[model samples]
Target: MDTPFEIFLSAPPGLEPLLLQEVTEAGFAAPEVAQGGVTIQGDWPDIWRANLTLRGASRVLVRFAQFRAFHLAQLDKRATKLDWGAVLPAGAECRVDVTCRNSKIYHDRAARARVAGAIESFGGKVSPEGSLRIMVRIEDDLVTFSMDTSGELLHRRGYKEATGKAPLRETLAALFLRQAGYAGDVPVVDPMCGSGTFVIEAARWAAGMAPGAERSFGFEALPSFDADAFAAMKAEAATRRDTDLRFYGSDRDDGAIRGAEANAARGHVADLCQFTRAAVSDLPRPEGRPGLVMVNPPYGARIGNRKLLFGLYGAFGAVLQERFHGWRLGMVTSDGGLAKATGLKLSAGPPVAFGGLTVKLYQAQL
Candidate 1:
């Protein structure tokens, strides 16, 4: 348990560099960018901290062991040699997921069965309904064993039960906030806010609250889990501090506004957030120093008509240009022409996959 292992921070595709920057700033050691995520060497406690604090990671996985196998017989022999008892708690129930590529053992189900049998040999239970997950990847004849440290998706955040149609994910909102150069120093506003995702994320980040503070992790069921130590870590996290700064959100839909308000209350940031019903044409500039105005409006693909969306984007752009002086704008949409309709001198980031549609973040100074 004292020996360091590989920790993988799964990030949304096309946002790996931003997540890498975040991990580096978080003071994790020797974080290297990978194809789908970032990899770092750490012990068990580092796993806990990564899941608890990282706002951009979609999930956390720990790679405990790896080896080469030519066939199912060889894979079973190598897997049985692993000290499963050292990692999984006695009689632990877990589900195994396997992916095979460029390997002699191309049957993923067979590999999963072999590994599951090996785990059960150590008095552990393999069940599809298990709370814990064992991840197996066999690529190029090399097999790797990993465990999902995060049971539910990290974006769940345990507080946002009320969400709007095609709502922006909290993890995506945090990464976009970072991309917009928002460091929690000033006000944040989302005029077309849905469920207050951006505003609540900004408020929590500004207040120094942990992203996973209100949630439980799958690692708690592992043999390495130290409940007392995890409690101490949570206790030592930065507490909420009173600040004059506020995060504001408004939407044309009254029901959306109500849901946003409820989300803020559940997230314990109602005092720092204000949600009201308003239209894009009537969006108000909050009274404070110029900050970030981040919004995820209807993409036309999900919530609105594509032909009618141009006028909507044009109105939003006009409002920002007229009222939001010195503020930065981050707008997300799937159509490039709609972004151009804003008539602002905006630049776009790389394409991001969201809800089966390709979206990009358009930014500019207002």
Candidate 2:
């Protein structure tokens, strides 16, 4: 753990800047930005903080080792010679998740099989449904090994167990918040809030809370898992600052309200957010704050009827103009036509690649 290391935090495309900010804020002195991820030089403590505080990152990964190996024999010898027992427990359930990028080991499945076999022979057990995920990426013969510092990904922050047909991930929500510059001191609203993801993430961020405060990580069972240190760190993190603000969200469906309630309870922000069942035209118009109204309305793919969606967008536009006057608005959608339906003058920032679908979060003033 004392050696030089790099931590990679994967993010959606065009959200690298948000991830970079999170890495720097987590105490990385010099963070180098890469496509879909960020790299930092640090020790084990840095890795722990990255997992704990980085809300916008999908998962935190500690680069255990990275070296060049051009052939299978070289790869096998290096894998066998590496100190697998240091980070992974002996006989602990584990599996290899590999990715090959521009490397001689382009046969991803074969390389994964070889690596898994090597680890198994070295006393590492393969647990397909295990809690930990060990990621291996081979790029230009430089094989890199990293462990999933986050167990179920950062989006599964123990909240939002219930999901709609098309659900937005919590990490992506946080990144979108960063992109929108939400300060958490104002009133934020999310109409068409399926599962209440944006509002809940806003509540957690506004409370000055750690994203992983309620979850466990894979490194807890490793040899170097320092219980006392972790306890102290968590205790230090327990001091909460007061945030007297409201996060509002609404959805037309009743099940989304139930899921949002369960998620808020798990996230410890049930009291901070207001969830209701209403259409975009009937969304609550709170007074006295200049916060942004961010929404993730359904596209034609998820919800039925393309023509009605345009009418819904127009209603959304009218509501924002009449009810949420002088307040800024942000909308995330894959449909340019639907976005055009909302008559807010918006400047396009960047497109986020979310779950095989490319989305753009458009922001404008009412």
Instruction: Give the candidate number with the greatest TM-score.
Output: 1
Output the TM-score of candidate 2: 0.93
Q: For model 2, state the Cα shift of residue 259 in Å.
A: 2.7
TM-score result, candidate 1: 0.97
How do the predictions measure up, each by TM-score? Answer: 0.97, 0.93
Stretches of candidate 2 off by over 4 Å are: none
Cα miss at 354, model 2 (Å)? 2.2
Q: How far does residue 51 in candidate 1 sit from its true spot (Å)?
A: 0.6
Single out the weakest 10-residue window by summed lDDT for candidate 2.
232-241
lDDT for model 1, on a 0 to 1 scale? 0.91
Where in model 1 is the C-alpha error above 4 Å? none
Best-performing candidate as measured by lDDT? 1
Model 2 C-alpha lDDT per residue in residues 1-366, reported as the tens digit of each score: 345677788887788988898777767856988988888887777777777778888887888877787877788888878788888888877867889999888888887787887788878887677666788899978898888877778877765688877788889988888888775667789988788889988988888778887777877888767878987776665445688898888988899988888888888888898999988888768867678898888788666688889989999998888888778887888889999998878867688776677899889877
